[model samples]
Target: MATRPIRMFGDPVLRTRAQEVTEFDAALEHLIDDMLETMDEAGGVGLAANQVGVTKRVFVYDCSHIEEGLRGHIVNPVWEAIGEETQIDQEGCLSIPGVQKDTERFQTVKVSGQDKDGNPVSMVASGLMARCIQHETDHLDGILFLKRLSPELRKEAMAELRNAEWNQEPRG
Candidate 1:
């Protein structure tokens, strides 16, 4: 597996909704491996297909470190909240590069999707793991965490965003 280039925030592809994967073929499996490598290299908990310039409803995540031994991928995934929305947490994205912002998300979530082998799987996640899932899945739908930010905060972040460097190598 090799790390794939991540599409930056301003890329038009990042704003376009991803297409669902209909055929679980070799190429799809390859993409999943590449995505896992990419996410690992970038030190991200989750990554979406759109973030890698593939417009597909595919995302990979490994929250095992967060929840201890619970980790996997989500291809053509769909998610729903388990309860009422919860407080805001500061979230960051690999697509947005160095930028980070606060956003509100459900504290618990139930997601359904296929595994790398195309086997159907469903699981519930909560806390930071849940937030990460929501954030990454949103990217597949062309949604950014900044979209969930407060108007005032978003306005303030714009200036910083303008000055932010998108192509900078991740800090060690």
Candidate 2:
């Protein structure tokens, strides 16, 4: 496994909705492995395939810091809000490095998807785990966490992103 470059925001791949994975193969496995390595190296809880320039529905996450033992990759994931309640917290993205905004997310969620090998997997998540799942799934759907921000906050985030030093640097 190798660390792949995390595609920064404004890259077309991040805006394009990812295609569902139909064949579970080595290429998919490689992407997943690389995504995991990239996320770890970048110190992010979650990294989507699209965030790494792959337009396949896949994401790797390690939310163990916030929720112990909460880590893995998911392919073709779908999640449902579990309750009427919501939680607002500061959320960041690997694609849009250095900018975090208060975003609202469900209190709990039920996610179902397949593993890299095409095996079915499902889980119930709350707290940061649920938030990470929602955030990564949004990437697969071409939605950024900035979209979840309020008008004022989004404007602030946009200005911040506009001037981020990383924006001028070359990405691997």
Candidate 3:
């Protein structure tokens, strides 16, 4: 599988909600494989299709450092916050690089989606796994971690994004 060039911030595909995957075919498989390779090469915990300039509702994650990390691609995922408990921690994204800001996220989450092969898949995870899952789900919905920041933090994040030279580079 080839490592796809990650789309930077301001890319329209990242802002547009990815279309649900209806065909579980060879192309989908290839995309997932490429995404996994890209994520690994980029040293990111997760990578979404939109981050790689594909508007398909799919993401690949690997949070093996956590005990119950959910590692694999989820197609057309539906995620929910599991409890009232929350954790505030620094969060970063592959698309929006050079910025890590404090973000609040549910400590536990439940996600259900199809696998690369169109098989049913579900998982309940906490800690880094949960955070990664939620982060990636947000990408599929045309949302970024920057949107989750508070007003002041969001403003600061916007400024940081604007000042990043890489953000102005042409999409490869």
Residue 36, candidate 3: how far off, in angstroms?
A: 0.4
Clashes in model 2: which pairs?
none
User: Where does candidate 3 stray beyond 4 Å?
Assistant: 168-172
lDDT of each: 0.85, 0.92, 0.91
After superposition, candidate 1 runs with Cα above 4 Å error: 167-172
Better of 1 and 2 by lDDT: 2
Q: For residues 3-70, what per-residue lDDT tens digits would candidate 2 score against the true structure?
A: 98878888999889999999999999988888888899999889999998889999999988876778
TM-score, candidate 3, is: 0.94
Which scores higher on lDDT, 2 or 3? Answer: 2
- RMSD to truth, every model: 3.6, 2.5, 2.5
| RMSD of candidate 1 to true structure, Å | 3.6
Instruction: Please write out the lDDT profile of model 1 over residues 58-146, one tens digit for every residue.
Output: 88887888678665678888999998968687888887766677788999999998876789989888988889779888898999888
Instruction: Sort every candidate by TM-score, greatest first.
Output: 2, 3, 1
Q: Estimate each model's TM-score.
A: 0.92, 0.95, 0.94
Model 2 TM-score, all chains together:
0.95
Output the number of the TM-score-best candidate.
2
